[model samples]
Target: MTKYVSCRHHSQSARSEHQGAVMEALEGGRENAIYRKGELVSRPASHWTMTVHQLLQHLHSHGFAACPKAVSIEGGKELLTFVEGETYNYPLEGPIGSLMALKSAAKLLRRFHDASESFLKLNTQDVHHWMLPSRSPKEVICHGDFMPYNVALEGDVVVGVFDFDTAHPAPRIWDIAFSVYGWAPFKTDEDDKMGTLEEQIRRAKIFCDAYGCTRLEREELVEVMTLRLTALVDHMRSMAANGDAQFQANMEDCHHTAYLQDIEYINKHHQAITLGVLGEIKF
Candidate 1:
């Protein structure tokens, strides 16, 4: 059975060290084991957590504060300082659907990528374990999943992002492609889609513009978006086949089918989207 856990983002209650803190569960697309306590969030730790923590530290050292601070790992749960702000899921509406939100998210993603570049250059990959395999050109550590729900917002502005479980080394476009897929949200799911294809393309252009995406990146955006979503579906099925209960449950609910449908939707409109985002034609 699929379980949905929602926890309050802010809390003021105090606790003694001897007393056990409350563990408020958090919900995400793939996992349900996350929990929040006062100012700290805890989730199941994987083999790659140390490497991810190193990346977080590197970002923090470079003066980037929009991501969670890796506190410590204990009893198989990785603890991170909670980013205090509102978070949202599907059916993007209100502030999350605003142009400002898209622009801020895009800019923030760019900042994150830029901040991570030095870390990528300083570290050797073979020594570190990552949940997802590193992609070529190793531009930055992709947040792996930078969906709306993963971001913390103050009004329409994206202030911080959490849940770094999927962070991996990949090209800028590899991450940007997936981020745009969620922010532009070329979703075919009834509950998740926001506007028409034209509207979506316009939003995509706004995002790429704010992030200052290269002409080359814009030219190849549509193909990358489709490829990214297809990779997600493949990963979902692969995890399910490998006995990951969360993924198996996701499969039961046909999440992979939803992604596949969206991939088709993007491909159907790829030309217009490519042209639209390229600013060559108005939709």
Candidate 2:
């Protein structure tokens, strides 16, 4: 990570050393550009940035400190405190694939949802905006993209989460279903898959149990997962058609095709998955 330092505060050699470490820590590929200076993360500001910042502040006031603190916007960039810890993406391996990681993520997600419920209760204004569309029965604000890549981990324990760009008002199950897809790794893509279908189903059960899901939520999980992915595909195509460069590139690369395949995979095994997560049938 390259560290950016003020010329007034340090010698040339010290600044270079800081820049290298900081930049290394911040490096990763995603749809949006991200930069870091000192302990602040900088990303392009959007019309919804202030609304998201309000939600973050609400979470913090309610004692959920595992997320970023929204700082000020400057020069068309939104700044947030850089959360410390290692982040992993697809192809989960080592600590990322451990049982501890799965359980911890589920627990943390539950905490986040509980805290967010109050936000929904308190904020009655219609001035808020989110990148993702709100869903039916908006019980709590959903961390719309609660996947492995979006969380920060210390060893096998997930300590923090980031990327509120996709945050939206949705049901708790809506978020959990997509999260299970990522962590249980219900994917056919060779680059992202971690286990066989049976293994994935088993992991999903572990996640549900850790999160203390109701039987109703468990029964609805498989169906919700498929619907979520379908919605994702439609959103990608719609955005690409509307000239969003990131989604345009993704469409060109046939990223939507991969999700379509996963959707089919889930549909094909929907019955087995429903039974497995419900503990009525073993995987």
Candidate 3:
């Protein structure tokens, strides 16, 4: 990550060593244009940040610190407290790519869901428009994209989860499905490193155990997974049709085809997938 010394600090340019993590925009986050400078990261705020900010503040007060603390918005960008840790970027390998890492993510997500129950009462006014509507009365805020790259780590432990751009109110199963796709990576094997289907399902079951989902929730897993992927394909196609540069490129690159294939596999093996999730792991 290259450093970016601010023009305001022209007089102290020679003392550049005093700067914290330099103003380098880390890639891999598809939604926000993010840049890190010193002890702060600046990114353009959206309709969701305000709601997310309130949620983070609440979570912080309630003993959850796995997310960036909202600082202030200046110059059309919101400044956030920089969390120091290695991000689990793409093509996950080694310790960071193991089932234990997935377990940590599940635990953190469980904590967030537990804490987020009070968020609605705290901020009843102007719910963030970006949040998807609740499927029913029983819903919590889903991180939307709780993938490997979004999680930060120290060794194999997941320390932080960034990228709140997709936070929304939805069923617990909805969030679980999304996490399974990105973390368990339910997609078709795009790399030789991807484990066998049984291995993947076992890992998914491990995640569920760590999350402590009930038997009923376990039964709902496969269906939710299918629905999540189907909706994703629809959204991607819609985005591409709407002329989104990213989605257009994804379509041209056959990402859509890959997603469809994954959905088909999940549906074909729905019964087995449920059994895998429901089966007890003997520690």
Residue 195 displacement (Å), model 3: 0.8
Clashing pairs in 1: none
Q: Please give, for residues 144-249, the per-residue lDDT of candidate 3 as tens digits.
A: 7777766777888888887776777777888888787666666574551257678778878888889998899899988888888787778778878999787787
Q: For model 3, where is the 10-residue window of minimal lDDT?
A: 1-10
lDDT for predicted candidate 1 compared with the true structure = 0.81
Question: Candidates sorted by lDDT, descending order?
Answer: 2, 1, 3
Note the Cα lDDT for every prediction shown. 0.81, 0.81, 0.70
Encode model 1's per-residue lDDT on 205-266: one tens digit a residue: 99889999998899889899988878888887898899988788788888888888888999
TM-score per prediction, in order, is 0.92, 0.90, 0.85
Worst 10 residues of 2 by lDDT: 1-10
> Which sections of candidate 2 miss by over 4 Å?
1-25, 28-32
Best-matching candidate per TM-score: 1
1 versus 3: better lDDT goes to: 1
lDDT of 3: 0.70
How does model 2 score by TM-score? 0.90
